[model samples]
Target: MPLLILGLLVWSVPHLFKRLAPEMRAGLGDKFKGVVALLVVAGVVLMVIGYRGAEVVPLWYPPSWTMHLTDLLMLFAVALFGLGNSKSRLRGRLRHPMLLGVITWAVGHLLVNGDLASVVLFGGMLIWAVLSIFAINAREPEWERWQGGSVAGDIRLGVITVVVYAAIAGIHYWIGPSPFPM
Candidate 1:
């Protein structure tokens, strides 16, 4: 749990730093980017360790039906993630699409997995996403709305999103938990 908490801190702090502490981050300059990257890697490692070490303490028993809901949320999450980085008409309408996707993903996982480790892991990420969005909004007042983009890009990206989502599902099953229930 402690390691997971530390990992969460490591993952979120450097990201929050630039927005929360502009001057300090500026002072660090180019090196700051490297530091943030290293911290992110270390954070992932720690979280993986912590999560694996943590005992399973189920908070709530999820119904089998929730698996369907998780699947729906994951599809939208992946599509939102794709739209976030893609040149699409929908892209202009969102401020933090990727963060929104993360939120959705965390919510989906939380809905299905109620163990202590799962809570700490997903809930921590959810909080980080929300906090980071607020911090970024506070720092940058003006948002440049999407101008225009070809629908073809969106279509292409949508196709790619489906493929990537399937790959992720496959990887998830290969790992431990099967996001796609049998």
Candidate 2:
């Protein structure tokens, strides 16, 4: 738990620093990017180790039906993630597709995982994404939507979304706790 909290802080603080302390971040210049990258990697390692070793303190048992909703949410989350990087017309409509995807992913995980570690991990990420969105919006209120997206881009996005989502599911199944509902 301590490690988990520490990892969350390490992961989130660096992300929030630039937004919260623009002058400080600017002072560091481009060199800080490497440091931030290292910190993020370390944070991820700590989080994985902490979460796996943490005592499983069950909070509430989610119903089997919630898995369906989780699956649906995950599918949408994947699509949202793809929309963020794709040149699709829909990409322009959203201001923060990646953060929205993170929020969706966290919510989906929270629906099926009702434990202390799970909450700390997923809920923390959810808070981080929401905070990032707020910080970005506060910094820049005006949003300039993307332009020149074509139908081919939308088709590409759809294909990639499906492939990535399937790959994620496959990885989950290969590792532990199969994502598919029993």
Could you say which candidate leads in lDDT? 2
Give the backbone clash total of model 1. Answer: 0
Candidate 2 weakest ten by summed lDDT: 173-182
What is candidate 2's lDDT per residue for 1-182, written digit by digit as tens? 99999999999999999999999999999999999999999899999889988999999999999899998899889999889889898999999999999999999999999999999999999999999999999998999988878999999998998899999999999988888887
Cα lDDT, all candidates: 0.90, 0.94
lDDT of 1 by residue, 1-182 (tens): 89988998998898788889999889988977988999999999999999988988989999998999999999989988888779778888899999999999999999999899999999999999999899889889799997776889789778988998999999989888888778
Error of 2 at 74 (Å): 0.9
Root-mean-square deviation of Cα positions for candidate 1 versus the true structure, in angstroms: 1.2
- Return the clash pairs for model 2, or none: none
TM agreement with the true structure for every prediction: 0.95, 0.97
User: Which 10-residue window in model 1 sums to the lowest lDDT?
Assistant: 145-154
Whole-model alpha-carbon lDDT for candidate 1: 0.90
